[model samples]
Target: MGLLDGRTAIITGAASGNGAAIARLLAAEGASVALLDIDGGGAANQAAAISDDTGAPVFGARCDVTHAADVEAAVFQTLETFGRIDVLVNNAGILLDTPLPGLDMTAWERTLAVNLTGPLRFIDTVAPAMIAQGEGGAIINITSIGGSLGFASYAAYCASKAGLMGVTRAAALALAPHRIRVNAVAPGIIHTEMTRGLYADPAALAEITAKIPLGYVGEAVEVAKTVLYLACDLSSYVTGTELTVDAGYVAQ
Candidate 1:
């Protein structure tokens, strides 16, 4: 039996990258999943692919986590189909590179909306459903090492993620009484479409890789596995924690 068998999950920003990877892994472990993304078509297609691969019940729909109506609709659909919501993965995020000399104000605002507040919007929606279930659940937010490491030219992204850390802690305490657990996954230098551009220049990629004690870039699956631990009983006693999957980058 898999760790998450008979459970249900809602994963945001699941059309591609880390979100998609996490969805696939959880479904493979026997959890039903609702994949939500701004790219509705892509999310639907990915749900089809994961369902085919795992034979797990999966749904996909358009959801802009920044919008309350979208989050509510998606959760309603997931509950209607799956009967209960057991895990919520807040993985939908955006990173716009606006340098200090002439930082784009629009980018700053948009980044906060998507990366920071978006997760909060989801938590406020999903937490109620989870509490109603009476069995409690898990909420995992995808933070970044940048939230602590402070990458140049990505101040808004960093600040938003750091803000999420605060959200995770506060939510964890508030939800603990109900057996619902809240946690954050902080990833470092993962090579995905969202982060591929950061490594496009060979010299820059090389420099970043050298800093990693592992001497290699990370993968989406690696982060997914960390998420799995938090999503299932393996982490039954864990909550209000920021687990770093950063190849020891923060250690230095």
Candidate 2:
């Protein structure tokens, strides 16, 4: 029996990287999953692959987290297919590295829209449904170390993630009575397409990896495992907390 057997999950930005890893893990653990991504085709293909690999009921849909209509449609579609939403992984986010000296407001706004407001849209659309389900649920937000440790050129990204931390805590308090748990997972220097650029430059990769106490880059599966823990009964008592999966980067 898998930890998430009979449960259902909705993972945003699940076409690739960490989001895809999380979806695959949860589905393998027996949860019906909806992989929602801006790249609809990619999401569908990944979902089909996971279904084949895990024999889990999984589907994919196009969802733009920044838009309310898109968020509503995706939630409706997931409920229509899976019957209930037991877990929500708000993994849809974008990072724009821009310094404050001459930062473009456009970049800042876009970053917040996708990274911060996007999660809000999902919570607003899904929380009420979870409450109505009466069985309680879990909401996990994907954050970054940039939220805590300021990055030189990541003002917008950092600010957005920090705001998400606030959202996770506030949402937890608001939904505690409903048995719904809200939490945030902060990943550090994970190997993903999002960080592929850094990998291309050996010097940059080494410099970045050197800062991590683990002495290496993290993988998507590791982050997925953390999300799985929070999604299942193993973390039943955990809520409104930020679990840092940064290879001890914050400790330094």
Full-model lDDT for every candidate: 0.94, 0.96
lDDT of 1 by residue, 47-87 (tens): 99999999999988999988889989999999999999999
Question: Which segments of model 2 are wrong by more than 4 Å?
Answer: none
Give the residue spans of candidate 1 off by over 4 A.
Answer: none
* lDDT per residue (tens digit) for residues 143-186 in model 2: 99989999999899999999999999999999999999999999
- Which stretch of 10 consecutive residues in model 1 shows the poorest summed lDDT? 191-200
**Residue 197 alpha-carbon offset, candidate 1, angstroms:** 1.6
RMSD of each: 1.0, 0.6
Number of the top-ranking candidate, with TM-score as the measure: 2
